[model samples]
Target: MILDVILDALLDTAKLIPFLFLTYLVMEYLEHKTKNKSKQIMQKSGHFGPLIGGVAGAFPQCGFSAAAASLYSGGVISAGTLLAIFLSTSDEMLPIFISESVAAGTILRILGLKVVLGAVSGSAIDVLWRFGGKKRREREEHNHIHREHHEKDIHDLCESEHCHCENGSIIKSAFLHTLQITVFIFLISLVIGFCVELVGSDKIGYFISTKPVVGVFLAALVGLIPNCASSVVITQLYLTGILGAGQMMAGLLVGAGVGILVLCRTNKGVKENLGLIGILYGTGVFWGILIEMLGIVL
Candidate 1:
Protein backbone atom coordinates (compact mmCIF):
# COMPACT_ATOMS: atom_id res chain seq x y z
CA MET A 1 0.00 0.00 0.00
CA ILE A 2 2.81 2.37 0.87
CA LEU A 3 4.65 1.53 -2.32
CA ASP A 4 1.60 2.16 -4.43
CA VAL A 5 0.96 5.47 -2.68
CA ILE A 6 4.56 6.47 -3.26
CA LEU A 7 4.38 5.63 -6.92
CA ASP A 8 1.12 7.52 -7.38
CA ALA A 9 2.52 10.57 -5.63
CA LEU A 10 5.66 10.38 -7.73
CA LEU A 11 3.60 10.29 -10.87
CA ASP A 12 1.56 13.28 -9.72
CA THR A 13 4.70 15.28 -9.12
CA ALA A 14 6.08 14.25 -12.48
CA LYS A 15 3.00 15.66 -14.14
CA LEU A 16 3.77 19.04 -12.57
CA ILE A 17 7.42 19.07 -13.67
CA PRO A 18 6.67 20.73 -16.99
CA PHE A 19 4.39 23.27 -15.32
CA LEU A 20 7.13 24.35 -12.97
CA PHE A 21 9.48 24.82 -15.89
CA LEU A 22 6.93 26.86 -17.79
CA THR A 23 6.12 29.08 -14.78
CA TYR A 24 9.77 30.01 -14.51
CA LEU A 25 9.87 30.94 -18.17
CA VAL A 26 6.75 33.08 -17.95
CA MET A 27 7.88 34.81 -14.78
CA GLU A 28 11.20 35.59 -16.40
CA TYR A 29 9.38 37.16 -19.29
CA LEU A 30 7.25 39.22 -16.93
CA GLU A 31 10.39 40.34 -15.17
CA HIS A 32 11.84 41.39 -18.49
CA LYS A 33 8.79 43.50 -19.30
CA THR A 34 8.70 45.20 -15.91
CA LYS A 35 12.46 45.61 -15.50
CA ASN A 36 12.66 49.37 -15.96
CA LYS A 37 9.38 50.18 -14.23
CA SER A 38 9.51 51.82 -10.83
CA LYS A 39 8.48 49.97 -7.69
CA GLN A 40 6.16 52.87 -6.96
CA ILE A 41 4.36 52.22 -10.20
CA MET A 42 3.79 48.57 -9.35
CA GLN A 43 2.64 49.59 -5.91
CA LYS A 44 0.18 52.13 -7.27
CA SER A 45 -1.13 50.03 -10.13
CA GLY A 46 -1.78 47.08 -7.85
CA HIS A 47 -5.16 45.83 -9.05
CA PHE A 48 -4.63 44.91 -12.69
CA GLY A 49 -1.06 43.70 -12.35
CA PRO A 50 -1.73 41.49 -9.35
CA LEU A 51 -5.01 40.21 -10.74
CA ILE A 52 -3.32 39.26 -13.97
CA GLY A 53 -0.44 37.69 -12.14
CA GLY A 54 -2.74 35.68 -9.88
CA VAL A 55 -5.07 34.46 -12.62
CA ALA A 56 -2.22 33.45 -14.89
CA GLY A 57 -0.46 31.87 -11.96
CA ALA A 58 -3.54 29.89 -10.90
CA PHE A 59 -3.85 28.22 -14.30
CA PRO A 60 -0.53 26.50 -13.83
CA GLN A 61 -0.28 23.47 -11.55
CA CYS A 62 2.95 24.12 -9.60
CA GLY A 63 6.16 26.03 -8.94
CA PHE A 64 4.54 29.30 -7.83
CA SER A 65 7.05 29.38 -5.00
CA ALA A 66 9.85 29.28 -7.56
CA ALA A 67 8.12 31.97 -9.57
CA ALA A 68 7.85 34.04 -6.39
CA ALA A 69 11.60 33.67 -5.95
CA SER A 70 12.24 34.74 -9.51
CA LEU A 71 9.93 37.74 -9.14
CA TYR A 72 11.62 38.82 -5.94
CA SER A 73 15.05 38.40 -7.52
CA GLY A 74 13.95 40.40 -10.56
CA GLY A 75 12.09 43.04 -8.52
CA VAL A 76 9.11 42.97 -10.82
CA ILE A 77 6.52 42.34 -8.12
CA SER A 78 6.34 42.93 -4.38
CA ALA A 79 6.05 40.45 -1.53
CA GLY A 80 2.31 41.07 -1.34
CA THR A 81 1.84 40.05 -4.94
CA LEU A 82 3.83 36.90 -4.34
CA LEU A 83 1.56 36.06 -1.43
CA ALA A 84 -1.45 36.66 -3.62
CA ILE A 85 -0.23 34.04 -6.08
CA PHE A 86 0.26 31.53 -3.31
CA LEU A 87 -3.19 32.21 -1.83
CA SER A 88 -4.93 31.61 -5.10
CA THR A 89 -3.03 28.92 -6.98
CA SER A 90 -2.73 25.21 -6.28
CA ASP A 91 -1.48 22.10 -8.11
CA GLU A 92 -3.90 19.81 -6.37
CA MET A 93 -6.81 21.68 -7.89
CA LEU A 94 -5.98 20.40 -11.33
CA PRO A 95 -6.13 16.77 -10.27
CA ILE A 96 -9.17 17.33 -8.12
CA PHE A 97 -10.94 18.89 -11.08
CA ILE A 98 -10.44 15.64 -12.93
CA SER A 99 -11.05 13.20 -10.09
CA GLU A 100 -13.85 12.48 -7.66
CA SER A 101 -12.57 14.95 -5.09
CA VAL A 102 -13.77 18.21 -6.65
CA ALA A 103 -15.66 18.85 -9.81
CA ALA A 104 -14.62 21.10 -12.67
CA GLY A 105 -17.34 23.41 -11.43
CA THR A 106 -15.77 23.53 -8.02
CA ILE A 107 -12.40 24.26 -9.54
CA LEU A 108 -13.83 27.13 -11.55
CA ARG A 109 -15.59 28.52 -8.51
CA ILE A 110 -12.40 28.32 -6.51
CA LEU A 111 -10.32 29.94 -9.22
CA GLY A 112 -12.79 32.76 -9.61
CA LEU A 113 -12.87 33.24 -5.87
CA LYS A 114 -9.09 33.27 -5.79
CA VAL A 115 -8.84 35.88 -8.52
CA VAL A 116 -11.29 38.19 -6.79
CA LEU A 117 -9.70 37.76 -3.39
CA GLY A 118 -6.15 38.14 -4.68
CA ALA A 119 -6.96 41.35 -6.47
CA VAL A 120 -8.84 42.77 -3.52
CA SER A 121 -6.13 41.88 -1.04
CA GLY A 122 -3.41 43.27 -3.25
CA SER A 123 -5.35 46.45 -3.77
CA ALA A 124 -5.94 46.77 -0.06
CA ILE A 125 -2.22 46.48 0.68
CA ASP A 126 -1.28 48.97 -1.99
CA VAL A 127 -3.88 51.43 -0.81
CA LEU A 128 -2.64 51.18 2.75
CA TRP A 129 0.96 51.56 1.65
CA ARG A 130 0.11 54.56 -0.45
CA PHE A 131 -1.75 56.13 2.42
CA GLY A 132 1.19 55.51 4.70
CA GLY A 133 3.55 57.07 2.17
CA LYS A 134 1.32 60.08 1.78
CA LYS A 135 1.29 60.60 5.53
CA ARG A 136 5.08 60.29 5.67
CA ARG A 137 5.43 62.81 2.89
CA GLU A 138 3.18 65.22 4.71
CA ARG A 139 5.21 64.85 7.91
CA GLU A 140 8.49 65.29 6.09
CA GLU A 141 7.23 68.50 4.53
CA HIS A 142 6.07 69.90 7.87
CA ASN A 143 9.17 68.88 9.83
CA HIS A 144 12.86 68.81 9.06
CA ILE A 145 13.71 65.72 7.09
CA HIS A 146 16.36 63.55 8.62
CA ARG A 147 19.02 62.30 6.29
CA GLU A 148 21.03 59.09 6.64
CA HIS A 149 24.67 58.76 5.64
CA HIS A 150 25.07 58.09 1.97
CA GLU A 151 25.87 54.50 1.10
CA LYS A 152 27.58 53.12 -1.94
CA ASP A 153 25.38 52.29 -4.90
CA ILE A 154 23.88 48.79 -4.66
CA HIS A 155 24.52 48.16 -8.35
CA ASP A 156 28.22 48.88 -7.78
CA LEU A 157 28.17 46.08 -5.23
CA CYS A 158 27.73 42.57 -6.64
CA GLU A 159 26.59 39.31 -5.04
CA SER A 160 28.24 37.08 -7.60
CA GLU A 161 30.95 37.48 -10.19
CA HIS A 162 28.38 36.51 -12.82
CA CYS A 163 25.51 38.58 -11.40
CA HIS A 164 25.86 41.13 -14.18
CA CYS A 165 25.00 39.91 -17.65
CA GLU A 166 23.28 40.76 -20.92
CA ASN A 167 19.51 40.49 -20.88
CA GLY A 168 19.34 37.56 -23.29
CA SER A 169 21.91 35.55 -21.37
CA ILE A 170 20.32 36.35 -18.03
CA ILE A 171 16.91 35.28 -19.24
CA LYS A 172 18.29 32.06 -20.63
CA SER A 173 20.18 31.33 -17.45
CA ALA A 174 17.12 32.03 -15.29
CA PHE A 175 15.06 29.74 -17.47
CA LEU A 176 17.49 26.88 -17.21
CA HIS A 177 18.07 27.36 -13.50
CA THR A 178 14.34 27.51 -12.80
CA LEU A 179 13.76 24.33 -14.77
CA GLN A 180 16.45 22.49 -12.86
CA ILE A 181 15.15 23.64 -9.50
CA THR A 182 11.60 22.70 -10.40
CA VAL A 183 12.65 19.17 -11.35
CA PHE A 184 14.07 18.66 -7.89
CA ILE A 185 11.00 20.26 -6.29
CA PHE A 186 8.85 17.81 -8.20
CA LEU A 187 10.81 14.90 -6.77
CA ILE A 188 10.43 16.31 -3.27
CA SER A 189 6.70 16.79 -3.68
CA LEU A 190 6.39 13.15 -4.77
CA VAL A 191 8.17 12.00 -1.65
CA ILE A 192 5.89 14.12 0.53
CA GLY A 193 2.78 12.67 -1.07
CA PHE A 194 4.01 9.15 -0.34
CA CYS A 195 4.53 9.99 3.31
CA VAL A 196 1.05 11.49 3.62
CA GLU A 197 -0.48 8.29 2.30
CA LEU A 198 1.53 6.18 4.72
CA VAL A 199 0.38 8.26 7.68
CA GLY A 200 -3.22 8.20 6.54
CA SER A 201 -4.27 11.68 5.42
CA ASP A 202 -7.85 10.88 6.26
CA LYS A 203 -7.30 10.27 9.97
CA ILE A 204 -4.96 13.22 10.31
CA GLY A 205 -7.45 15.40 8.47
CA TYR A 206 -10.33 14.44 10.77
CA PHE A 207 -8.37 15.47 13.78
CA ILE A 208 -7.62 18.80 12.14
CA SER A 209 -11.21 19.52 11.17
CA THR A 210 -12.83 18.69 14.48
CA LYS A 211 -11.71 21.89 16.15
CA PRO A 212 -12.29 25.10 14.20
CA VAL A 213 -10.02 27.27 16.31
CA VAL A 214 -7.25 24.71 16.40
CA GLY A 215 -7.75 24.08 12.73
CA VAL A 216 -7.24 27.78 12.04
CA PHE A 217 -4.10 27.85 14.13
CA LEU A 218 -2.78 24.69 12.55
CA ALA A 219 -3.47 26.11 9.08
CA ALA A 220 -1.32 29.10 9.87
CA LEU A 221 1.42 26.94 11.36
CA VAL A 222 1.45 24.56 8.43
CA GLY A 223 1.75 27.57 6.18
CA LEU A 224 4.94 28.56 8.00
CA ILE A 225 6.64 25.45 6.66
CA PRO A 226 8.04 25.96 3.21
CA ASN A 227 7.57 23.93 0.05
CA CYS A 228 4.66 21.86 -1.31
CA ALA A 229 4.66 19.25 1.44
CA SER A 230 1.71 20.86 3.21
CA SER A 231 -0.38 20.58 0.08
CA VAL A 232 -0.12 16.81 0.18
CA VAL A 233 -1.62 16.66 3.65
CA ILE A 234 -4.26 19.28 2.86
CA THR A 235 -5.27 17.63 -0.38
CA GLN A 236 -5.70 14.30 1.33
CA LEU A 237 -7.86 15.94 3.97
CA TYR A 238 -10.12 17.31 1.26
CA LEU A 239 -10.27 14.05 -0.69
CA THR A 240 -11.22 11.93 2.28
CA GLY A 241 -14.01 14.37 3.21
CA ILE A 242 -12.34 14.76 6.58
CA LEU A 243 -11.89 18.47 6.13
CA GLY A 244 -14.68 20.81 5.25
CA ALA A 245 -13.95 22.99 2.26
CA GLY A 246 -13.74 25.91 4.66
CA GLN A 247 -10.97 24.44 6.82
CA MET A 248 -9.05 23.11 3.85
CA MET A 249 -9.30 26.40 2.01
CA ALA A 250 -8.23 28.31 5.08
CA GLY A 251 -5.06 26.27 5.40
CA LEU A 252 -4.22 26.51 1.74
CA LEU A 253 -4.88 30.23 1.59
CA VAL A 254 -2.76 30.84 4.63
CA GLY A 255 -0.01 28.79 3.10
CA ALA A 256 -0.05 30.94 -0.02
CA GLY A 257 -0.07 34.25 1.89
CA VAL A 258 3.16 33.68 3.81
CA GLY A 259 5.24 32.43 0.89
CA ILE A 260 7.22 35.60 1.21
CA LEU A 261 8.46 34.23 4.51
CA VAL A 262 10.65 32.02 2.40
CA LEU A 263 11.57 34.91 0.11
CA CYS A 264 12.32 37.29 2.99
CA ARG A 265 14.58 34.72 4.64
CA THR A 266 16.58 34.45 1.45
CA ASN A 267 16.77 38.10 0.33
CA LYS A 268 17.77 41.24 2.21
CA GLY A 269 15.90 43.88 0.23
CA VAL A 270 12.81 41.73 0.51
CA LYS A 271 13.07 41.99 4.26
CA GLU A 272 12.21 45.67 3.97
CA ASN A 273 8.87 44.58 2.54
CA LEU A 274 7.87 42.77 5.69
CA GLY A 275 4.99 45.18 6.18
CA LEU A 276 3.25 43.39 3.37
CA ILE A 277 3.48 40.15 5.28
CA GLY A 278 0.80 41.21 7.72
CA ILE A 279 -1.43 42.17 4.86
CA LEU A 280 -1.03 38.71 3.40
CA TYR A 281 -1.88 37.06 6.69
CA GLY A 282 -4.85 39.29 7.35
CA THR A 283 -6.20 38.86 3.86
CA GLY A 284 -5.69 35.11 4.01
CA VAL A 285 -7.83 34.87 7.10
CA PHE A 286 -10.42 37.21 5.72
CA TRP A 287 -10.88 35.23 2.54
CA GLY A 288 -10.64 32.00 4.44
CA ILE A 289 -13.68 33.06 6.40
CA LEU A 290 -15.27 34.25 3.23
CA ILE A 291 -14.68 30.90 1.58
CA GLU A 292 -15.88 29.01 4.59
CA MET A 293 -19.00 31.07 4.93
CA LEU A 294 -19.74 30.78 1.25
CA GLY A 295 -19.30 27.03 1.37
CA ILE A 296 -21.84 26.85 4.16
CA VAL A 297 -24.27 29.29 2.62
CA LEU A 298 -24.12 27.94 -0.89
Candidate 2:
Protein backbone atom coordinates (compact mmCIF):
# COMPACT_ATOMS: atom_id res chain seq x y z
CA MET A 1 0.00 0.00 0.00
CA ILE A 2 2.79 2.41 0.94
CA LEU A 3 4.69 1.55 -2.19
CA ASP A 4 1.61 2.11 -4.30
CA VAL A 5 1.05 5.47 -2.66
CA ILE A 6 4.63 6.48 -3.31
CA LEU A 7 4.39 5.41 -6.93
CA ASP A 8 1.17 7.34 -7.39
CA ALA A 9 2.78 10.50 -6.02
CA LEU A 10 5.85 10.05 -8.21
CA LEU A 11 3.73 9.55 -11.32
CA ASP A 12 1.59 12.59 -10.67
CA THR A 13 4.58 14.77 -9.82
CA ALA A 14 6.37 13.66 -12.97
CA LYS A 15 3.38 14.66 -15.08
CA LEU A 16 3.31 18.15 -13.58
CA ILE A 17 7.03 18.96 -13.32
CA PRO A 18 7.48 20.10 -16.89
CA PHE A 19 4.51 22.47 -16.89
CA LEU A 20 5.46 23.85 -13.50
CA PHE A 21 9.05 24.49 -14.60
CA LEU A 22 8.00 26.24 -17.79
CA THR A 23 5.40 28.43 -16.12
CA TYR A 24 7.77 29.65 -13.43
CA LEU A 25 10.58 30.12 -15.95
CA VAL A 26 8.38 32.38 -18.05
CA MET A 27 7.10 34.29 -15.04
CA GLU A 28 10.60 34.89 -13.69
CA TYR A 29 11.87 36.05 -17.04
CA LEU A 30 8.92 38.39 -17.44
CA GLU A 31 9.40 39.80 -13.98
CA HIS A 32 13.00 40.61 -14.79
CA LYS A 33 12.47 41.90 -18.32
CA THR A 34 9.32 43.95 -17.81
CA LYS A 35 9.76 45.25 -14.31
CA ASN A 36 9.21 48.92 -15.20
CA LYS A 37 6.38 48.31 -17.61
CA SER A 38 4.63 46.01 -15.16
CA LYS A 39 4.90 48.57 -12.39
CA GLN A 40 3.49 51.26 -14.65
CA ILE A 41 0.55 49.07 -15.60
CA MET A 42 -0.13 48.17 -12.01
CA GLN A 43 0.07 51.79 -10.91
CA LYS A 44 -2.26 53.10 -13.61
CA SER A 45 -4.78 50.27 -13.48
CA GLY A 46 -7.24 52.27 -11.27
CA HIS A 47 -10.59 50.45 -10.96
CA PHE A 48 -9.33 47.64 -13.16
CA GLY A 49 -6.55 46.68 -10.76
CA PRO A 50 -8.49 43.91 -9.05
CA LEU A 51 -9.62 42.50 -12.36
CA ILE A 52 -6.07 42.33 -13.59
CA GLY A 53 -4.88 40.85 -10.31
CA GLY A 54 -7.59 38.18 -10.44
CA VAL A 55 -6.66 37.13 -13.97
CA ALA A 56 -3.00 36.96 -13.10
CA GLY A 57 -3.72 35.03 -9.93
CA ALA A 58 -5.66 32.40 -11.88
CA PHE A 59 -2.54 31.32 -13.75
CA PRO A 60 -1.90 28.26 -11.55
CA GLN A 61 1.19 29.56 -9.80
CA CYS A 62 1.70 30.46 -6.12
CA GLY A 63 4.57 32.84 -6.83
CA PHE A 64 2.12 35.49 -7.98
CA SER A 65 0.68 35.58 -4.47
CA ALA A 66 4.06 36.52 -3.06
CA ALA A 67 4.50 39.15 -5.74
CA ALA A 68 1.06 40.54 -4.99
CA ALA A 69 1.94 40.77 -1.33
CA SER A 70 5.07 42.72 -2.17
CA LEU A 71 3.11 45.08 -4.39
CA TYR A 72 0.52 45.60 -1.69
CA SER A 73 3.20 46.33 0.90
CA GLY A 74 4.81 48.82 -1.42
CA GLY A 75 1.39 50.40 -1.95
CA VAL A 76 1.73 49.91 -5.67
CA ILE A 77 -1.61 48.10 -5.48
CA SER A 78 -4.70 48.51 -3.34
CA ALA A 79 -5.94 46.09 -0.71
CA GLY A 80 -8.81 45.07 -2.96
CA THR A 81 -6.40 44.11 -5.72
CA LEU A 82 -4.34 42.10 -3.28
CA LEU A 83 -7.45 40.34 -2.03
CA ALA A 84 -8.48 39.56 -5.58
CA ILE A 85 -5.17 37.91 -6.21
CA PHE A 86 -5.48 35.86 -3.05
CA LEU A 87 -9.03 34.76 -3.83
CA SER A 88 -8.27 33.70 -7.38
CA THR A 89 -4.94 32.04 -6.70
CA SER A 90 -5.30 28.24 -6.85
CA ASP A 91 -1.69 27.32 -6.18
CA GLU A 92 -1.11 23.79 -7.54
CA MET A 93 -4.75 22.87 -8.11
CA LEU A 94 -5.09 23.79 -11.80
CA PRO A 95 -1.89 22.17 -12.99
CA ILE A 96 -2.49 19.14 -10.82
CA PHE A 97 -5.99 18.74 -12.23
CA ILE A 98 -4.63 19.06 -15.75
CA SER A 99 -1.89 16.53 -15.10
CA GLU A 100 -4.44 14.13 -13.63
CA SER A 101 -6.50 14.33 -16.83
CA VAL A 102 -9.45 16.13 -15.34
CA ALA A 103 -11.84 17.37 -18.00
CA ALA A 104 -10.84 20.62 -19.66
CA GLY A 105 -14.44 21.84 -19.42
CA THR A 106 -14.46 21.29 -15.69
CA ILE A 107 -11.15 23.13 -15.35
CA LEU A 108 -12.53 26.05 -17.32
CA ARG A 109 -15.60 26.21 -15.14
CA ILE A 110 -13.51 26.28 -11.99
CA LEU A 111 -11.25 28.99 -13.32
CA GLY A 112 -14.16 31.06 -14.51
CA LEU A 113 -15.88 30.82 -11.17
CA LYS A 114 -12.75 31.83 -9.29
CA VAL A 115 -12.08 34.77 -11.59
CA VAL A 116 -15.61 36.09 -11.34
CA LEU A 117 -15.77 35.66 -7.59
CA GLY A 118 -12.46 37.37 -7.12
CA ALA A 119 -13.21 40.32 -9.33
CA VAL A 120 -16.68 40.95 -7.96
CA SER A 121 -15.73 40.51 -4.34
CA GLY A 122 -12.63 42.63 -4.65
CA SER A 123 -14.45 45.44 -6.42
CA ALA A 124 -17.25 45.42 -3.90
CA ILE A 125 -14.81 45.59 -1.04
CA ASP A 126 -13.09 48.57 -2.56
CA VAL A 127 -16.36 50.36 -3.08
CA LEU A 128 -17.47 49.67 0.44
CA TRP A 129 -14.18 50.86 1.83
CA ARG A 130 -14.44 54.02 -0.18
CA PHE A 131 -17.93 54.71 1.11
CA GLY A 132 -16.76 54.00 4.62
CA GLY A 133 -14.26 56.85 4.23
CA LYS A 134 -11.24 54.61 4.13
CA LYS A 135 -9.50 55.68 0.98
CA ARG A 136 -6.59 53.46 -0.06
CA ARG A 137 -4.70 56.22 -1.78
CA GLU A 138 -4.76 58.35 1.33
CA ARG A 139 -2.01 56.19 2.75
CA GLU A 140 0.29 57.02 -0.14
CA GLU A 141 2.66 59.14 1.90
CA HIS A 142 3.14 56.43 4.51
CA ASN A 143 3.55 53.80 1.87
CA HIS A 144 6.00 55.95 -0.03
CA ILE A 145 8.17 56.22 3.06
CA HIS A 146 7.83 52.49 3.58
CA ARG A 147 8.68 51.83 -0.04
CA GLU A 148 11.81 53.91 0.18
CA HIS A 149 13.04 52.01 3.22
CA HIS A 150 12.04 48.75 1.61
CA GLU A 151 13.98 49.58 -1.53
CA LYS A 152 17.00 50.55 0.54
CA ASP A 153 16.86 47.20 2.32
CA ILE A 154 16.71 45.37 -1.00
CA HIS A 155 19.55 47.38 -2.35
CA ASP A 156 21.70 46.59 0.69
CA LEU A 157 20.81 42.90 0.49
CA CYS A 158 21.60 42.77 -3.21
CA GLU A 159 24.94 44.40 -2.54
CA SER A 160 25.91 41.30 -0.60
CA GLU A 161 27.78 38.58 -2.53
CA HIS A 162 24.94 36.06 -1.96
CA CYS A 163 22.37 37.83 -4.08
CA HIS A 164 21.68 36.08 -7.40
CA CYS A 165 19.33 38.64 -9.00
CA GLU A 166 22.24 40.78 -10.15
CA ASN A 167 23.78 37.78 -11.90
CA GLY A 168 20.79 37.21 -14.26
CA SER A 169 20.04 33.75 -12.94
CA ILE A 170 16.29 34.13 -12.75
CA ILE A 171 15.85 30.94 -14.78
CA LYS A 172 17.98 29.03 -12.32
CA SER A 173 15.94 30.43 -9.46
CA ALA A 174 12.72 29.42 -11.21
CA PHE A 175 14.06 25.90 -11.82
CA LEU A 176 14.98 25.51 -8.17
CA HIS A 177 11.57 26.82 -7.10
CA THR A 178 9.87 24.34 -9.41
CA LEU A 179 11.84 21.42 -7.98
CA GLN A 180 11.04 22.55 -4.44
CA ILE A 181 7.33 22.79 -5.10
CA THR A 182 7.29 19.44 -6.94
CA VAL A 183 8.97 17.72 -4.00
CA PHE A 184 6.47 19.32 -1.65
CA ILE A 185 3.55 18.10 -3.75
CA PHE A 186 4.99 14.60 -3.96
CA LEU A 187 5.43 14.32 -0.19
CA ILE A 188 1.98 15.70 0.56
CA SER A 189 0.28 13.52 -2.04
CA LEU A 190 2.06 10.43 -0.78
CA VAL A 191 0.84 11.10 2.74
CA ILE A 192 -2.68 11.73 1.54
CA GLY A 193 -2.72 8.54 -0.50
CA PHE A 194 -1.52 6.53 2.49
CA CYS A 195 -4.11 8.06 4.74
CA VAL A 196 -6.84 7.29 2.28
CA GLU A 197 -5.63 3.73 2.04
CA LEU A 198 -5.44 3.28 5.79
CA VAL A 199 -8.67 5.03 6.67
CA GLY A 200 -10.70 4.16 3.58
CA SER A 201 -12.23 6.70 1.22
CA ASP A 202 -15.78 6.03 2.37
CA LYS A 203 -14.96 6.94 5.97
CA ILE A 204 -13.16 10.08 4.94
CA GLY A 205 -16.00 11.02 2.66
CA TYR A 206 -18.54 10.50 5.35
CA PHE A 207 -16.67 12.83 7.70
CA ILE A 208 -16.55 15.70 5.21
CA SER A 209 -19.92 14.99 3.62
CA THR A 210 -22.02 14.90 6.77
CA LYS A 211 -23.24 18.50 7.15
CA PRO A 212 -22.85 20.85 4.23
CA VAL A 213 -22.17 23.92 6.38
CA VAL A 214 -19.63 22.16 8.54
CA GLY A 215 -17.95 20.68 5.51
CA VAL A 216 -17.60 24.05 3.83
CA PHE A 217 -16.18 25.66 6.93
CA LEU A 218 -13.79 22.80 7.52
CA ALA A 219 -12.62 22.92 3.95
CA ALA A 220 -11.99 26.65 4.20
CA LEU A 221 -10.00 26.10 7.36
CA VAL A 222 -7.89 23.50 5.63
CA GLY A 223 -7.21 25.97 2.84
CA LEU A 224 -5.85 28.48 5.36
CA ILE A 225 -2.87 26.24 5.97
CA PRO A 226 0.16 28.08 4.53
CA ASN A 227 1.55 25.59 2.05
CA CYS A 228 0.80 23.81 -1.22
CA ALA A 229 0.13 20.65 0.79
CA SER A 230 -3.35 21.89 1.67
CA SER A 231 -4.18 22.21 -2.03
CA VAL A 232 -2.78 18.76 -2.79
CA VAL A 233 -4.85 17.22 -0.01
CA ILE A 234 -8.00 18.98 -1.20
CA THR A 235 -7.45 17.88 -4.80
CA GLN A 236 -6.74 14.32 -3.77
CA LEU A 237 -9.86 14.20 -1.64
CA TYR A 238 -12.01 15.49 -4.46
CA LEU A 239 -10.52 13.04 -6.95
CA THR A 240 -11.17 10.15 -4.54
CA GLY A 241 -14.81 11.17 -4.10
CA ILE A 242 -14.15 12.09 -0.51
CA LEU A 243 -15.28 15.66 -1.23
CA GLY A 244 -17.84 17.17 -3.54
CA ALA A 245 -17.38 20.12 -5.89
CA GLY A 246 -18.70 22.61 -3.34
CA GLN A 247 -16.28 21.44 -0.69
CA MET A 248 -13.38 21.42 -3.09
CA MET A 249 -14.26 24.91 -4.31
CA ALA A 250 -14.39 26.22 -0.77
CA GLY A 251 -10.95 24.82 -0.05
CA LEU A 252 -9.40 26.09 -3.25
CA LEU A 253 -10.87 29.55 -2.81
CA VAL A 254 -9.29 29.95 0.56
CA GLY A 255 -6.11 28.12 -0.36
CA ALA A 256 -3.96 30.99 -1.51
CA GLY A 257 -0.91 28.91 -0.59
CA VAL A 258 1.60 31.25 1.14
CA GLY A 259 -0.17 34.42 0.07
CA ILE A 260 -1.75 35.16 3.42
CA LEU A 261 1.50 34.30 5.15
CA VAL A 262 3.38 36.70 2.94
CA LEU A 263 0.79 39.36 3.54
CA CYS A 264 1.21 39.02 7.27
CA ARG A 265 4.96 39.21 6.94
CA THR A 266 5.00 42.18 4.60
CA ASN A 267 2.10 44.30 5.84
CA LYS A 268 3.36 44.84 9.41
CA GLY A 269 -0.06 44.71 10.99
CA VAL A 270 -1.72 41.70 12.59
CA LYS A 271 -5.19 43.20 12.42
CA GLU A 272 -5.02 43.54 8.63
CA ASN A 273 -3.87 39.97 8.17
CA LEU A 274 -6.65 38.70 10.40
CA GLY A 275 -9.18 40.72 8.46
CA LEU A 276 -8.00 39.25 5.15
CA ILE A 277 -8.30 35.75 6.56
CA GLY A 278 -11.83 36.42 7.72
CA ILE A 279 -12.81 37.81 4.33
CA LEU A 280 -11.27 34.89 2.47
CA TYR A 281 -12.88 32.25 4.69
CA GLY A 282 -16.25 33.99 4.62
CA THR A 283 -16.23 34.38 0.86
CA GLY A 284 -15.16 30.79 0.30
CA VAL A 285 -17.89 29.35 2.53
CA PHE A 286 -20.49 31.59 0.95
CA TRP A 287 -19.56 30.37 -2.52
CA GLY A 288 -19.47 26.78 -1.38
CA ILE A 289 -23.04 27.03 -0.11
CA LEU A 290 -24.14 28.90 -3.22
CA ILE A 291 -22.69 26.22 -5.48
CA GLU A 292 -24.38 23.50 -3.47
CA MET A 293 -27.68 25.31 -3.71
CA LEU A 294 -27.27 25.63 -7.46
CA GLY A 295 -26.67 21.89 -7.78
CA ILE A 296 -23.53 22.34 -9.80
CA VAL A 297 -21.50 19.17 -9.93
CA LEU A 298 -17.85 19.04 -10.88
Global fold similarity of model 1 (TM-score): 0.68
Model 2: per-residue lDDT, tens digit, 15-126? 6566556654654554667765655665578599889888998988776776676456545577788878888998889878988999999899999889888888888877
In candidate 1, what residue range of length 10 has the lowest lDDT sum? 152-161
Report how far off residue 35 is in candidate 1 (Å).
6.1
Candidate 2 to truth, TM = 0.65
For each candidate in turn, give its C-alpha RMSD to the true structure in angstroms: 5.4, 6.4
**How much is 141 displaced in model 1, in angstroms?**
7.4
Question: Any idea what lDDT model 1 has?
Answer: 0.55
Q: Which stretches of model 1 miss by more than 4 angstroms?
A: 1-46, 133-168, 175-207, 257-262, 270-278, 290-298
